[model samples]
Target chain A: TQLLEQSPQFLSIQEGENLTVYCNSSSVFSSLQWYRQEPGEGPVLLVTVVTGGEVKKLKRLTFQFGDARKDSSLHITAAQPGDTGLYLCAGDSYGNKLVFGAGTILRVKS
Target chain B: SQTIHQWPATLVQPVGSPLSLECTVEGTSNPNLYWYRQAAGRGLQLLFYSVGIGQISSEVPQNLSASRPQDRQFILSSKKLLLSDSGFYLCAWSPPRKLQETQYFGPGTRLLVL
Candidate 1:
């Protein structure tokens, strides 16, 4: 089974603090996706990385895919209260199937 | 523009009761549909996925079952509810054109078994 392990299951920081969440796996994936979920809602797609060593940025968020396609990271710069949520990383294994990481719960207090 | 809709934002049912959750997509055709469950403090668990009508793939064998009666509609049902089944259920869809397509998620349904 393909499994993605996420680090720092819970993180709480004050506003303007920076943090990074990591997702690692032994199995290589064809693609990886990052999502942000708030309470009482489904996760929203933050970014998708398909190629090795690829980087994508969305405003204050930065996403990176590992060189072997077996890991990924999400970095938030100057986090605000609005950035508080559960960050998840998912890896595509087969056709339309995704293996998800444990997830990182972030809380940014303003 | 594409959108996905999941019904009954929240539900509280007694144990052993039947359960049914519906999901539908609009503005897209021949999309891949997926059902995922998320427990508190954990990530999503792939429950079921449908590539086409009447084609369902189970990721984990459990009390849950899924069906797709049409190209744009998917349903999750169970004959008996389990207390462990209570969680946030999310429905998602992706256009089947790319190998690594991004999925769009619905508002989701929160089920609580009492």
Candidate 2:
């Protein structure tokens, strides 16, 4: 079973458009993280949210951890072509393990 | 500052051939190390993890195995490679004893087993 479920496995948008990707799970996590991966490269950590109902913003990107700690959302404002990549959400399963969602592939056309 | 490295960025092997992929982390000690496989540009499937030397945990049962011979080195090995073993293998590490789980990933090794 997929511990975490991410919506909109693939998305394509025009530059300046806004978009959001979601990660949900029935099990509560100790923490959640967002990562962006370019083709042929390792995924890079974008942000981490630990507390319930915590919201974090990095430039035009926004991340929110659900109040119950079982869900997270990543929103991008005025999306740019440079933002095209695979966006993945991972939940901390403790014991230094993580459960990951299938990830969302976003393509922004300029 | 710590950096993770994976060698032979890409590999192509035949069935029944032996396989070995190495990962090493520099500038850290006693890190929480992990091995993951990614397919179709999607989520990571945790294959194995280790918290210390000579200690390895397998998350999935398969033809592969892992070993940690040194504090900062982790190796994934298989006696006979299978065609199903074709995929991108990734290595990652997190700070020691931190529960928050912010992991840093190394450039992956793409293995194509024929």
Candidate 3:
């Protein structure tokens, strides 16, 4: 059973386009993190949002934590081919384990 | 300034064979460690976590077990490998400050059980 759900399991777009991915859950979380993974590498931390209604940005990526702490969103601006990879959002519920969403595989054609 | 490392970037093991994977953390002490498995085309599943030496919390009952013998060391071992164990194993750590901490992951070990 997946604790978190991500929308648009697969996305393909041309360069310069914009897209948004979402992660939703019924349970509340203390903090949420966004990660990007390449073809053969582990997921790299992008940004973290701790407070409800928090928003953080890293370069072309923007992250938002829902006020209720049960959802999050990641938006990419002017997407590039280099951004093609898997995007994952994980939530920490008060322990060592991080519950991850199903992930969104994005493909940007140059 | 913390780093996490996992051994055997890629492994090919036969079924029914014993398996062992090791993870180590540097530049931090008494950190919270975690073990996660990602099947092909699937999301990560938390297997176990540890808060301190000799402390383990398992989230799933599987053929695998984890141990933390040292403050900076965590190990995942299996008495007998199963084909279902073929997946990407990731090791992560976060400071023990809060439950909502952001965990950093290692490069991960890709295990292929034949």
CAPRI quality of model 1? medium
Q: What is the DockQ of each candidate?
A: 0.60, 0.68, 0.62
> In order, what lDDT does every prediction score?
0.91, 0.93, 0.90
Better of 1 and 2 by DockQ: 2
Clashing residue pairs in candidate 3 are none
Q: Name the runs in model 3 displaced over 4 angstroms.
A: A94-96, B97-99
Q: By DockQ, who's the top model here?
A: 2
lDDT of 2 at A73: 99
Best candidate (score: TM-score): 2
Q: Taking the tens digit of each residue's C-alpha lDDT, what string does model 1 give over A1-108?
A: 888999999999999999999999999898999999999998899999999999999999999999999999999999999999999898986554677898999999
lDDT of 2 by residue, B1-114 (tens): 899999879999999999999999999989988899999789999899888999898999999999999999999999999999999999999898763488899999999998
Model 2 chain B scores worst on lDDT over the 10 consecutive residues at B94-103
- Off by more than 4 A, model 2: A94-96, B98-100
After aligning candidate 2 to the native by TM-score, how far in Å is the CA of B29 from where it should be? 0.8
Best to worst by DockQ, what's the order?
A: 2, 3, 1
Q: Candidate 3's residue-wise lDDT over A1-110, tens digit each?
A: 33999988999999999999999999998888889988657888898899999999889988999999999999999999999999999988865357899899999999
- TM-score to true structure, per model: 0.95, 0.97, 0.95
